[model samples]
Target: MKKKKISLGDWIFNIFLGLFFTLFTLICIYPFYYLIINTISANDISANGQIMFLPKGIHFQNYIDVFKIPDLASAALVSLGRTVLGTIGAVLGAAYLGFMFTQQKMWARKFWYRFTIITMYFNAGLIPWYITMRNLHLTNNFLAYILPAIVQPFNIILVKTYMESISPALQEAAEIDGASVMKVFMKIMLPLAKPIMATIAIFAAVGQWNSFQDTLILMTKPALYTLQFLLYQYINQASSLAAMIKNGTVISTSSLATMQTPTSIRMTVSVVVILPILLVYPFFQKYFVKGIMIGSVKG
Candidate 1:
């Protein structure tokens, strides 16, 4: 094939596009760069409110201090558990529900499907949701993190619609071989549905990991607190940090002074909270795109 020459208009458009994207990319990167710089810099550099396009007087004490915070380890464990279990539960539950919704054996599928769709558009207010969870005795329990999020209507619908696009003959053949619905789902459908499930898993994990509101509302016990809520308390409640300083670990008055005047350790906490998701995202990104695009266009 002969190469086509680019028109002057196309050249101009490409230049503009490149410039726009460069600016956008810088905008996105700036915050993380600032956080890293502030996190690594010495207390004096950070306290001076220096313009930090680049790091100054680098040190790692901020991260050390963040680690030294009280219950941070336990809270991290809770967050990690919630992310893993909640993601698996939500994805598998959605997949199973999606599979069942397509089955002839499911009773009142139309009514239930419509009802699920309706719930998406209309929500009972937060007060009712809070009261309902309270009445159900979910408060101060780890179950609060995973159970409430397991049934994601949007995800179920995506999986269901994608499943519908699978050849009916495969299902019929399995049924003819005396393979039960559960067996077929476990052996066949799930394996074939990996791409979409990966996509939903990312969504579910990020949501569960970053869920601060639920912890704040549902948990009163310190032991039940998630990393997100712990960080939130550190930000909003000075007394909380003061308590941590008294009990968690000892830091110098100068370290404490930086927080009071200029430098904020909360930036380090933000980086810690976000770092895992950032690291994990690239692995799922392809699947996320593939799942949404294919699931949308075909099914």
Candidate 2:
């Protein structure tokens, strides 16, 4: 094959494009960079706040405070459980139901499918939503985290589209061999649909792990709070505590002196909260892109 030489104009454009994106990427990353430095640096907390770029003094005590905070350990456990259970529940439920939607034999599948799709666009608002959860007795319940995610329409639609793209002959062959619908789904479809499942599972896991609004809305008990809600409360406490310090209500001579400043602790909490996702991402990186693309393909 003959090689086409790049024109000077093309060379200029490519260089410009590369530089533009490089700057944009750096800009996007700066906030996380700031967060990292602030979280790890001890001197920055007590210093005159002059330094922004480089980490001032290293300290793990901020992290210690995060772990030691009241109700936080329990909340961390809840967040972890919710991420695992809620992700599995949402992915399996959505994938199974989505596969069922592709089956012609399923009763009222169209109406039911349409109903679920309608839910994607509409909600009854906060009051009715609260009432419904209350009636279900989900208020102040751990089930609130896992149950609500089990039937996400967005995940269903993604899985459905990907499943529909599979050959119908696969299912028919299983049926001819005396395989039940459940067996076919369990033994065949589930295995074949790994990519899309992984993709949506990532989505569900991240959402479930990060969710705190539901806790705020439904949970009154401190024990029931998720890590995120605890973090939220910590941020509020940070502001309130700062106000107390400024007003001299919380004297430096008191126990507050030994306590990690709310700002430092808040940053530590952010790092702790996101650390799981960071660890989990590398495992999913290979399938993540493929799953998203394949699932989005038209059936």
Candidate 3:
């Protein structure tokens, strides 16, 4: 059989599509690039909008200033601990709930599934949640961030959907081998569900990493502050800036000339906050892509 040659129109259309997508990608990425550059560039240059794709005058002093904030390192440790523990809890809980929902013989499965789904669309507002947390004595505790969001309903549904697509024959074979429910889940189902598990792990990790509201509301103790909440406090406290000035903290006069140039500090703080997650993402990049592909097909 003679292979058909590419049509001119199809070639042109593809070329146009590629160019369009390239431009869109650049448009999306440039703002983050600009923010990164702006944070490192001199305050004067940033204020004048002279910094764009490149740093105008390189400086590490903003980062130094950020570090000098009291207990910044401790706050970072707290955030890291919370994120790790929360992600693990959520992934395990969601996976178990998802697997249970997938079982044909599970009693009242429809009622349980519907109950979980209802939580996805509705939430008891913040005050009521706060009151409940207080009643549970979770306020000002690390568990405040962990316990409330451990079983994400949407994640459960996603995992369950993925689980439902697994071959029934495989499950039956496991049963014939006299495997218990737990063994079937751990050995057979979990191995087969790696892609979705990876996806949920990433989602849960990122959500915990970026979470601020829960920490803000439930944790009032300074020692328990997560990175996000600590950064927020640093940003809000005029006294921090005033104390820096009073202590003769080595801020450039050029930076001080425009006191508000600490906007760059905000950008820098964001980069710092997200840097760990960025580093961790590449390790899971393959699994992440696989997970999305599997999820889309199953969902």
Candidate 4:
């Protein structure tokens, strides 16, 4: 069959939509591109804000300076450990809860779901949360970061949506074969829901990896600082260190002198901190897209 010819109005509308989306995409990506360029550029050029789309001069000194900072590597390891454990726990717990809520016979399911939903909008204020954490002896503990955010309501909601989309015939078949609810969930549903699980896992992983506020509030020891908290301290305190060096209070050798260029150092730290998430995202992109499309269609 011959294809229908495109009309002038359709062509005009398509051109307008393309230009609008292209402009939106550029606006979204320019900042990250600028950041990557500025991070590798010399600090002198970055400080002047002249490095926009490209670096004025190439430099790896910022990365070397970041390495020189004491406890950087150790703090990164601590953050990595916390992120891995917390993300796993969150994904598993949320998935189980989602599966449970998907069952028609689950008692008080509406009330429980409402309770979880309420948490999404309403939170106990910082002071009350801090007091509770202190009372529970979670302060200064790694659990302080991991436990509080383990079962986010948004993730639970996503999992529940995905789980509900599974055909009821599957569960009925499992039950007919003498499988209990737990066995059915573990053996059948969980395996089939890998796409949604992976999507949720990526979200949980990125959130935990970038978390800094919880560590700042719950952890007092410098040794327990997450990558983000360490970077925050570095950014906030670097100027004071630079001033000390200028006043001769702190001696600045060639290695130590690089501390003064924290503009580039901060950018480099951001790039480094975000690199893992960037690398992991492409692996999950297909799963994420599938999960979203499935949920949207089913809904």
Clashes of each: 0, 0, 0, 0
Candidate 3 ranges beyond 4 A from true positions:
1-18, 237-260, 296-299
In model 4, which runs have C-alpha deviations exceeding 4 angstroms? Answer: 1-29, 241-259, 296-299
- What RMSD, rounded to one decimal, does every model reach? 4.5, 3.4, 3.5, 3.6
Number of colliding residue pairs in model 1: 0
lDDT of candidate 1 over 1-299, digit per residue (tens) = 99999999999999999999999999998999888888777655665678478776676776776677799989999999999999999999999988998997789988887787688889999999999999999999899998988888889888988898889899899999999999999988999898899989998989999989999899999999999988876666545555656674546765653442224556777898889999999999988998887678643
Q: lDDT tens string, model 4, 168-231?
A: 8999998999999999999998898888888888888888899899888888898888888888
Where's the lowest-lDDT run of ten residues in candidate 2? 42-51
lDDT of model 2, residue 21: 100
Tens digits of per-residue lDDT for model 2 on 1-299? 99999999999999999999999999998877777787777633543454488876666666766677798879888888989999999999998999999999999999999999999899999999999999999999999989989999999999999998889999999999999999999999999999899898889989998889999999999888898999887777777766666787866553442445666766677887787897898898777898889888873
CA displacement after TM-score superposition, residue 61 of candidate 3 (Å): 0.9
* Model 2, TM vs. native: 0.85
Could you tell me every candidate's TM-score relative to the true structure? 0.83, 0.85, 0.87, 0.84
The Cα local distance difference test for each model comes to 0.83, 0.84, 0.82, 0.82
Tell me, by TM-score, which candidate is best.
Answer: 3
Model 4 is weakest, by summed lDDT over 10 consecutive residues, at: 252-261
